[model samples]
Target: MPRTILILNGHPDPSGKGLCHALGEAYAEGARTAGHEVRRLDVASLDFDFLRSQAAFESEAPPPTIIAAQADVLWANHLVVIFPLWLGDMPAMLKAFFEQVLRPGFAFSYRPRGFPVMHLKGRSARIIVTMGMPALVYRWYYQAHGLKNLARNVLGFVGFAPVRDTIVGSVATRGRESIGRVLEKVRELGRRAV
Candidate 1:
């Protein structure tokens, strides 16, 4: 079935010419080829304040970029986030993007008794994380902490269900062939629209 997909490149680098960015493009290509409507949000290109102050969150109106991003999130049935793990976690810019865009009332609302009401329901997400360490090490030793944080805590909390992830590691030492293989895998995932 055709679906609306949003690919977010969360790399902090403004150039958008790295492994993460390539993976995002590959995914977008496959998704488009599969007849899905695709939109991309390059975090580094957005002109907005990353630091969210108490007043900002309390403010009724958020920045225009954030509002626009929220609209995109609402438009997409599937969200694909491609980012590099820096210092065993996501880049600060990516974190800031979530902090600014996934605001209260937009992504969620508090409930009197139970958990907060998730507004971004009926959506699925895929997180593709690139790291310098071996993939097995990150999965076993670190227990995929970063992936769990985003998949469960952030996206799942907001009602993105069946959240899936792909971990690509040893990126720094990977050759062209290895990178090509990874890109192909990501493209296949996109083709499935999963």
Candidate 2:
């Protein structure tokens, strides 16, 4: 069945020629070829305050861009996020974007007891991350900390299930051939609407 997909380019680079951006485009292309509806959000192009004060969090009204992003999230059956890892975490802007868009009430709401009910259920997600170190080293040595944080903590917390990831590492050392192979793999994933 054809599904609605949202591709979020989280690289914080508006020029859109880096590995992360390329991967995002490849995925979008594949998804479109597979007859899925696709929408894209490049974080760098979004005009919004990245700094979220406590008051902002408490407020019901978020910035206009954030509201729009939340609507996108609600619209998508699947989400694909492509970003480069810097210093073992997502870029500050990407992290801040998540903080703003996945706000309370939109992503989740508290219960009288126990965990909050997840409002964004019935959605799945895939995370494609590029990094400087080898992929295995990042997975084994660093315990895939960043992926775990996003897949388990953030996305899962919001009720995005079956969150999977692809870690493309040694990006700085990889040649065009290797990068092209990675892009193809990402495209295949998109083709399946994964």
Clashes of each: 0, 0
lDDT of 1: 0.91
In the range 103-187, model 2's lDDT, one tens digit per residue, is 7778988789999889989999999999999999999999989889999889999999999999998988998899889989999
Any residue pairs clashing in model 1, and if so which? none
Q: Which pairs of residues clash in candidate 2, taking residues 3 or more apart in a chain or in different chains? A: none
TM-score of each: 0.96, 0.97
> Candidate 1's residue-wise lDDT over 58-148, tens digit each?
5558779888999999999999998999888899889889888787888998788999999999999999999999999999999999889
Give me the runs in candidate 1 sitting further than 4 Å from their true place. none
lDDT score, candidate 2 = 0.91
Give Cα distance to truth, residue 103, candidate 1, Å.
0.9
lDDT of 2 at 12: 86
